[model samples]
Target: MPSIPLPGFQPPESIQEVFLNPGGFHFGTTDTRIVTLLGSCVSITLWHPRLRVGGMCHFMLPSRGVIPEGAGYDGRYGDEAMKLFLGHIMRIGAEPEAFQAKLFGGANMFADMAQRCEINVGERNIEMGLLQLERYGIPLVAKHLGGESHRKLMFDVWSGDVWLKSEQGRKPR
Candidate 1:
């Protein structure tokens, strides 16, 4: 896909950023600004307005079961990452109901991989995230999922808000 410039993205030479790799997660106050690139992966951002605390996780697979042996439950899986993310934010005094969630990064980027897997990882991720959120009764405020372009995700920890950009420069609904 040809890259389309995003409206809010800073020029390459401009802003400094903290980039989160797959399987990694971070939580903090509004002082944090984190970024990640995703394709056929999912990232969830949680924030509590009252507490002014927030978190973000970049997960590769829907579950740990799909990974090979010796791979312990980790942030790369949606289930495990959700647990860890919620746990961290809770430690700082965030309640389940107080959290507002925004989901991003579930794009079917490769045709070959999609054909081989027979299931879209992106779609599975969306389902898993929604199910888990429903289980906790946490409200999902927004989402950008299931497309053909990779996403660039950004989280502002203090406000617990996130923004998304893709090669197509499509904004969230």
Candidate 2:
């Protein structure tokens, strides 16, 4: 049998799809694409343009107090999530300065309640993300934060592109 090459026909790249949950994180090479839905939570994506490797974290709270002995790192808190990201980056022998960061989510799902509460979790989560990025000297190239709607976030490690679709006035089921 003779084979014919068709013009404009190309094989699709094999992508590693990951759906990140609240208090979870994932990091991998160019083949990885991470997706997550956020409401009153924050997600930070770090991508190394040169190495084509990075990760993302979904954190619900700003920080947590004293940790009990033998307690492992929990991504639920923004502080702990940042620590997890740092640990992975360090293990891979990469410096924070080499990566570009993106911030998303931190929506005030309960608008009326937020005004009465002493601490707004959504705002605090955004603050924590900004502070940690500053502390580590990671440049925040893009951000979509502090809204009143939920967001569906998708991050591509290969292209370092982030796609955000806001579910305005509707809560995720």
Candidate 3:
């Protein structure tokens, strides 16, 4: 018996989909797509084409310094997230120096956040993303940051591509 191909049907590409919520990350060598929704949060994607491997992280806070009693330390902090990201990259037998990085999210979802809290979490996240990459000597290829709109980001680890879509009528400040 011969199986006939269905009309207008095509096999799906080999892609692993992962959704990174706040305080999460994913690392893989296969063709992977990582998605995240951000409002005053940030996500970073690192890819090493030579090794055909990559990783992504979504973090909500800047650091764990002076964490409240109930707010235990976690990857939700930018500093912690970076440590975890780099650790995993190294564990996977890849050096951080070889990774090409792309940064996304980091929108100031609140207008009065700075005045009230004396800081903008989104901007802080973006800053941490850039600073950490530079500190680790990773090549930051692209970045889409510092906006007032929420962002929906899709990152392709295999190709080192990040697709960013912002909420309607919102612009970077």
Candidate 4:
């Protein structure tokens, strides 16, 4: 067998796989990449233009206080995740005042769960994510949230492009 080289192709700088479990959050810098598989949880991406830095966090719960155990050491709740993500970007020389945001996930895949609460967990997650962005005064520029399907998101900090993959199709921003 002979090997053939593909044309017009370049390898990614680095690839880091991250699983945002039911309650998990993570932040990354321009040199680091972040990826997540989401269902009913919500993921928020915050980016700063001047510094070309960004971070993303996937949160299962809307508020940290809602969980009796507190967000623990992981800070998995949406509110805590937002704060941590913002802090991380700022630490990397990104200006908080110049940051923009984008939200994804928060799908109602488990419609059955909706009957248990006045508002669906997925909906609450989206609401809380937006609220957190607003509280931090970050402008939300884009979003691909809601519906009843799971999503896989890959974020490039340097380019500030978020790629979303779902059963239906792929959306790049």
Candidate 5:
């Protein structure tokens, strides 16, 4: 899909680019684009329309369950990733509500395993993202969640545009 450009915004001469790996997160200002590949993992993108600043996180799991204080934050976990995003928002003197969020990924790559397990990781990851967004009062403006194929996603922080392309023909049996 074509990206909808933000009004009154001019493209920067050079835009910073970031490719996030599983368990990774990135936050930056207007001239940034973050990309990631996903299967069962989930990614949350947050953008502030006014400031043209935001971040994205690729998390593999729902939670690590009450990490001990002083332990560093791990972007691998959904909860921790949200906290990481929050810390950055605060550091930039922005409120969580000022941001618009988008969610992607959380595909069921192992159908049989997911059915056999009590809780599916992909589903849990997606749920964790939704819960965290609500808990922080950040509005989730868009999402493409839960499927059988992998996905490649790109988020443009400058325009709050997210482009998602589903990788077809690889559904789990």
Candidate 6:
């Protein structure tokens, strides 16, 4: 196995590793894990009770329709990304009724620009995420959202333990 370095933090050595960069999602059972950084964007985790399987998505945009044509696929969009993440979990045998969600991020990092379009995107992302989860009948188990600082998240696929690291604080679930 190759060694991967994590800046300012120790990296774990394992056969299976999953890294979720900004605007990305990864779902699978592996000895490795999933990791991501969140700013104004929102990260949502959905896990199945029976299968112990789940996925995480970091989305930056509130909706996809606002993006212009030919912009390609923006995984950062909440609506688009959430659908894709949920669909992937479902494909792997996760039932909607059996899954619960955990959401984080949507920081008001751009507070100075509150009057600008950039400031409201974060709030919109959170709103759309909650609405979408409710629409799908999935209950939200926990959340650590809306603040002024970014976050670093690590999700252990094998154990389903989510570690949220942020300047504000850490919430483990």
After aligning candidate 1 to the native by TM-score, how far in Å is the CA of 91 from where it should be? 1.3
lDDT of 3 by residue, 1-173 (tens): 11233343222378678998888888875567788888888888888877767888899988868757776347788877788788878787788888888888788788686879878888888888888888889888888788788888887665566777787645664
Misplaced by over 4 Å in model 4 are 1-19, 66-73, 169-173
Residue 3, candidate 2: Cα error in Å is 30
lDDT by residue for model 5 (37-134), tens: 99999999999999899999999999999898899999999999999999999999999999999999888888888788866788889999999999
lDDT by residue (1-173, candidate 1, tens digit) is 22244454323433235688988887766456778999878888888876766778888888866656776558888988888877776677667878898888777777578799797787788788877788787899988887788888877655454776688733323
Off by over 4 Å in 5: 1-6, 169-173
Candidate 1 residue runs with Cα over 4 Å from true position = 1-17, 66-73, 169-173
Q: Candidate 3's error at 83, in angstroms?
A: 1.1
CA shift at 111, candidate 1, in angstroms?
2.6
User: In model 6, where is the ten-residue run with the lowest total lDDT?
Assistant: 1-10
Tens digits of per-residue lDDT, candidate 4, 33-113, equal 678889878888887766666778888888757545543434568887877876686677665668889899888877776
Screening candidate 2 with a backbone cut-off below 3 angstroms (N, C-alpha, C), the clashing residue pairs are none
- In order of listing, the candidates' clash counts read 2, 0, 0, 0, 0, 2
Q: Model 2, 48-131: lDDT tens per residue?
A: 987888999999998887766999889999888989999989999999999999999888888888888766788889999999
* Rank order (by TM-score, best first): 5, 2, 3, 1, 6, 4
Flag the better candidate by lDDT, 5 or 6: 5
lDDT (C-alpha, whole model) for all candidates: 0.75, 0.86, 0.78, 0.73, 0.89, 0.74
2 versus 5: better TM-score goes to: 5
Error of 3 at 73 (Å): 7.4
Residue 66 in candidate 4 has what lDDT? 52
Off by over 4 Å in 6: 1-15, 30-32, 66-73, 116-118, 169-173
Cα deviation of 91, candidate 5, in Å: 0.9
